[model samples]
Structures are given as C-alpha cells and as structure tokens.
Target: MAERKAFHVAVVGATGAVGQQMLKTLEDRNFPISKLTVLSSARSAGKAVLFNGQEHIVQEATPDSFEGVDIALFSAGGNVSKELAPEAVKRGAIVVDNTSAFRMDENTPLVVPEVNEGDLHLHNGIIANPNCSTIQMVVALQPIFEKYGLNKVIVSTYQAVSGSGTQAVEELYEQTKAIINEESYEPKILPVKSDKKHYQIAFNAIPQIDKFEANGYTFEEMKMINETKKIMHLPELKVAATCVRLPVATGHSESVYFEVEQDGATVADIKALLKDAPGVVLQDDPDNQIYPMPADCVGKNDVFVGRIRQDLDEVKGFHMWVVSDNLLKGAAWNSVQIAESLIKIGLVK
Candidate 1:
C-alpha cells in the first residue's frame, strides 16, 4: 500500500487580505498539511485567526519561522517578502511569493500555473505569483495564444479596492454610505497610496494605479506588460495596459484588445477555445444579458471571460472582458494552485 505524504505549510502575513484568502483556499482545497504555521508582522502577532475550524494565533514572522516549514505562502508587502522570503528558502522551504519583489528577477519563475506551470521546474527557490491583474489576463489569453497565436495585447483594468487591502475596502464602504447620508469625508488611499495625490475611489474610477513611470505608464500597467511577456515567454509580443481603480471591493475586470497571429480566426473560435481552457469560465450570452461582471465573480477561483467579438476593421483583432476575484484567482488561489502544481510534479519536498 502507498502512503500519503503531507507537508508543513506556513502562511506569511496571515492577517492580511490575501493571506487570509490563502489560508481559506488551502482549507477549501483540502490541501495535505501535516502542520500549518500562521505568520504575520510583529504588529499582527498574537492575533487569532480561524482556520479549518480551529483558532490559530499568528506568530511574528522571523527568519527562524521556516525551520520546519515545507512550503511558505507569502502575501506580505514587498518589503516583508524581500527580507524573509530568502530566509525561508535558505531554511529549506519553497516560497511562493505574492509580491513584485521577485517577479522580474531572472532567476525567479513568474508563474500562473495554467500559463506556465512548466516554468515551475526552473525555480531556484522562489516562485512568484504575477500581479493580480496580470494573473487573470494571462489565464484568459493563454488558450487563445495557444491556438491562434498572439501578436499584440492592450488591456484596461477596472480594479477593486480590495487589491489595496482591508483599509481600502473599509474606506470604500464608509465613503459610499457617507455620500448617501450627505456627510463630508476625506480621501486618503487610492490611485497610489504613497503618491502625492489622493483620490476618492467611491462613486468614481481612478484612472491611475500605482506610481507612474517615466515612460508615462503607471507601475500597475508596467507590471501587466512585463509580467505578461515573462509568463507567456513572449517578450517580443506587443503588450500595453492602462489600469484604473473602481468602487468595487473584491473583483477585478479587464477589457482586453488583442490581435491574433492567425488571420481567419472568428469570434466563435475564440469563445470555443476559452470555453475549454483550464482555469477559465466563459459567460458570454448577449441575448440573455449574460456577461462577466465583478459582482458575480466574488469568491470564485475561475477567470470569467466574456464579451468576445471581432474588431470592426482589423480581421485579426479581437476583444474580451476578463473578470475574477482579485484576491482569489488573481492572488491567493493562484499561489495555492502553484503549490499544488509543485506537489503534483514532484518539485516540493
């Protein structure tokens, strides 16, 4: 008889938004865990976190936290990941980092599992979860790229406040209620939290996300562009993005314009392709008013794609609307999925 192997898993920044989701996903998926360690910054240490019907206190994450951990899921801020992810690795844990700190690192595999599970074999010690927006976009596009070939992609995102964290989500709810009651409120955390300007995210759409680069694209846009190329291994593919923040709290929606390499591909062909693509959900029925939307995608793990159509003029051009729970499929679910992939492919110890 064969014996089942269970892993010692650690969730870094366990109290944070995506961290909580990571724990939930692990529990929901019934991952094989011999032991689970919940870690957070010193500020969140001693906080109680409910996991798998048990209350676990989050410990202050330190270099020693990874001593016996087989896999560490990190959703902390970039600075936290920068300092501890390597420490976890040095201690023999494979770190699935959900931050930009290592996504562009040549040695770190920027993984989306569905698009580049094979890239997992190339990981040195860290596997990076691509940015939330980048994850969904690539999932919806991978099948298309596989069948028709892809020439260029341009994406405009309608993102949610949860992408910024709990504080932002609370602010959105408070601000909305305040406006309804005609109360004055101050804006503090949108577009870019640390940027010189602040904008209201409730009853508004902030056209910028992250700090703008000298090239005029916001940092979020650059992440989408670069991460797309890296994940799909299409460095020469033309990709552009404009990111915007909306009033929603959990899901992220993207309008993607793409040009396929194949000339005669039809809208039906694209829909047929995505309908069977792994990790993708097709929901496009215009006559029945069925289409992907942020409201309907909350708590779901599949990337919802809809509104597929051919360009008015360009025979090779097509458009799609991609939506997913930014915290789930976009971040937490993908990280866990990679960990699952690692186990299935015999990469994790």
Candidate 2:
C-alpha cells in the first residue's frame, strides 16, 4: 500500500478563541500534519501555543506566511482574511476561511460539508465557512430537505457569548459576577462590538447579533438567510432569520421552522432521516424531556437535533431544534473538515 501523505498546515489567528479551537480540533482529529505553522496578529504574534503536545510559537501573519503551506485554515477577523487569504492562495495553499470576507463572493463557495461538500470542487482556491448559527442549522436541515424537498425556512438562533469571541465571554462572566454581588458593571461588548452601543449580555437575551443593515436584518441574520440559499443551491428559496445572543458560553442553538415541498411528510419521517444523517445526532425523545441545548453541546463536533414536530396550522411546515459547539463545528471543525474534504477528493496534495 502507498504511504498516506501528510501535508504542511497553517492556521491563521492562532491566538483567538476560534483559532485555539482549530488547533485543538486538528490535534483531536489527528489530522495528518507534516508541518504546522501558527500565525496571528502582530499583537498576539510571539505567543506560545501547544499542538500535538509540542509547543509552537505564533508568528505575525503576512503574505509570505503561506509559503510551502498546503492547506490554511483562517479564523482571524474578516479584515485579516481579506488581506491574507489571497496571499495564501497565491502561494498555492487552499484556504478555508472562517469569516464573512469571502462567503458572498460569487467566485468562492460557501460550504457546509454535509450539505455541499461537492461545491468544494468549484472553489477558486478558497472555501467560506458559513456562520456558526448557520452551520448547525444546515446540518440538521439537509437530510430533511433531501428526503422531502425544502421550499422555505425561518430560523431564530440562540447563540452563545463565545460566538462574539473570548472578550465577550469574559464580559459576560464579569457582569454576571458583579450583578450577583450587587456591584455595578459596564457593558463593553455584545450585539456587535464596533457598533455605536453595547448591551448587557449576562442573564439577558440580545435580539441583535451583528449590526443591522438598511433592511433591518442584522448582518448575522442576513448571513443565515443568504448562506442557506447558496449552500442548498436554492436561489429562490424563501429564508428568514432572527439571531439573538444569549449568556451561554459555548454552543449555538436554533429554532428552525421549514416548509417541505412534498406533501404528507410526517414528523416520524423527518426524525428517521436526521437519525441516519452524517454529522448529526438525533435526541428527540420529548417524553423524557430530551432536547439539544447549548450547555450540553459544548466541545462536541456533531450537530445535535431534537424537538421535531409538525407545525399545527401549516401542513407543510415542520420545526426542530439544532445545536452545536459554535467554536468547533461552527468555525474550526468546519474549516478543518473542508481541508479533509479537499484531501479526500484529491483537490489538495
């Protein structure tokens, strides 16, 4: 048998929350790595990160960083991805970007592996990972769509604080502590950090995730709406989203309502389809009070689904709950999964 080849891998934003998870996931999955290069912003450049039980120093990311890299997983902010992803691609590295920078680019493919792994073939040297909320939602919906044909989708996400990054998670912790002790704390992050105002995220639900656009839908919501359509290859599919940030720290949960085109599809049929779906777990025993929740889903790579039921009034509509670790499956694992798909399909050497 020919020896399985290992490739040189580069991880951008090695010090951020999602970046750290990416490294851990690569290690946990035992991804074949001939060489590993960790890159971060100048501020975080000199930090030490441990991968595969070996300490590696992070370097500041630049155009030259991708030299000799076979695959690059990008989790830095969108601006950094915008600046460096092309450079990485120019250097012969296949980039799986975990940012909004390239998702809407017609030349790039927005991928959720279970739903559109085939789209990776059309990539122009880069693949875009969908939003954290969108990733889990699509994983749970794909099987049902394949079995019953989808016409419309409406999703309301209950996202965790960690989706906003480590700083927001810290803010939630500090504010919760202060509030419990009868002390005052100021809000500095949540519901979009760069926006004109910040809101409390501890013990409260913020209806906004990213800044609102002219259409009044937050960028996060628009991402779910548009990305869903693109991944499903349903350009005219009706999709709407309402994204909300909650105090939970790791997982993202969504209440998804979708209308299937085929008539007479029962709740039992959807459950059976999702039960056999790849990268999905079915936990829909409502009699025992079982359902997917953020706290229980932390650190897992699979999307957990539950609470499946048919809409009372709409014969074609069905609802289900979907949850997954935002950092893992949402960002890091998805990026790594893309790379794996690339190797599996012979897109990367």
Candidate 2 per-residue lDDT, tens place, 33-75, comes to 9999999989899999999888999999999999999999998
Candidate 2 global CA lDDT score? 0.93
Off by over 4 Å in 1: none
lDDT of model 1 at position 163? 95
lDDT of 1 by residue, 1-349 (tens): 8676899999998999999999999999999999999999999999999999999999999999999999999998999999999999999999999989999999999999899999999998899999999999999999999988999999989999999998889889998999999998788877677899888888999988889899999889999999999999999999999999999999999999999998789999999999999999999999999999999999999999999999998999999999999999989999999999999999996
The C-alpha TM-scores of every prediction are: 0.99, 0.99
Weakest 10 consecutive residues of candidate 1 by summed lDDT: 184-193
Reference-based lDDT, residue 260, model 1: 94
| Clash tally, candidates in order | 0, 0
Off by over 4 Å in 2: none
